[model samples]
Target: MTKEHILPKWMREEFPELAREPVFQGSQNEHDGPTPDGPRTVYRGGKEESGPFNRQAPVVCGPCNNGWMSQLETNVHEPLSRMIRGLPTVLTSERQAVVALWSAKTLMVAYRAPHFGPRPRPEVILPVDAERLYQDRALGPMMVMGLANYQPTPYAREPLYVQSFTRMEHEGGAYSYCATLRIGHFAAQLVRCPDGMYPPLGQIPPHLVLLRPGASAVHWPPSRPIRAGAEWDSFVNLPEETGT
Candidate 1:
């Protein structure tokens, strides 16, 4: 009944990969992709340290095709009921509200302004309702969906990618959840490049963000009045008994 549980649908569908990757907020706040021939100089704690010099580096100076930048393209107001009508599972209208709210909130967080350089430039323009994402209590909450090991861009240290419980952003402050990643593996570039530098668009290592790793890891949550995970039914099981 508290604010955190009242999220919308956009949050779910858009930020579906939440708590799946190693998410870093301002570490790479520079979403302005660099020119293809660009050379990035990162300091690994001084001492004449250096990292990979990929001309493929993106610039935080301007918006690029990073998937995170496509937030504005998502249909936030779309009804989850209509989206899930064909499913065999059962959900309530009130729960549907929760599902939609969750989804909306997810998308907003995903669409949240991608790191812009020293100025005001958002790589991901965010949903059309940018104002509402932050203002709406149901959508106000935010969470960083990533594996602890998922390294943040521009940082030399490799993310632990270990399973752990982190804070969830809501109106009140932060909340904790027992989360683990289910995205076993993906056809990502799999480059062993030293830390930082992830694709700005689409699921790079497109994997699952499970509620619990190993045991009950899955793509969706249990059905209430609203539903999610059904979106991932094709990839993971969405049986009501399965909790989605």
Candidate 2:
């Protein structure tokens, strides 16, 4: 039981709408379910659980979980949630960074989950830049982020589905390791590479818009009432025929 890292009081003040955010008090062990990996799966929500960060999983540790990260959650919550609730959103670089950081944080915690057991394979696990993220509250220089919308399940309770996978890309005489996260209607991909080896967002297979660091905002969903599925895999494994 992680008692020390409770949700901070300041969060409620910053995002009062959080009061409406539904909290799932289901048995953690019962709620324990298999999380999707490339083709296999790993169990999440077991003996120990952290959470309710704005009613989402607070899967990181004390200092790494609150304050700084909380601010990122706050900045993007409204826009992201509104987009999920069927509204137009202008995703700015700043907000996109929030998506990247939050996705990376989720991956970081997943990497540390006990169910992965002793000595999980290194390639499947994300090399999280937690120290850099905690210190600066920003994506490390090597990381790039992007986003897109997908069809949703009709009238489903707000779902905060998030999934990540690691990939190796060869560039600039080295491999650029990256991770992509699918969260609800949007997917945020973060790539960390050696200096000068970073690839731009356009290289990603999905027709995602580049969440360029420090770039201007762009109106997303280019269409109205964007819908998303209930599961993370729905977005991650979206058919190639679908548009972003």
| Tens-place lDDT digits, model 2, residues 56-122 | 3335666644456566666666776665444667777777666566666655554454432343233
**Cα miss at 52, model 1 (Å)?**
26
Name the candidate that leads on lDDT. Answer: 2
In order of listing, the candidates' clash counts read: 56, 5
Off by over 4 Å in 2: 1-61, 115-120, 124-128, 152-162, 169-174, 194-196, 201-206, 222-244
81: Cα error in model 1, Å: 18
The per-residue C-alpha lDDT of model 2 at residue 160 equals 42
Query: Model 2 compared with the native: what TM-score?
Result: 0.56
CA lDDT scores, all candidates in order? 0.25, 0.48
lDDT of 1 by residue, 113-208 (tens): 222123112222223344554345232223223211121233353221211111111122211221222211210011011113222234423342
Residue 213, model 2: Cα distance from true site in angstroms: 3.2
lDDT of 2 at 236: 36
TM-score of each: 0.21, 0.56
Q: How far is candidate 2 from the true structure (C-alpha RMSD, Å)?
A: 8.4
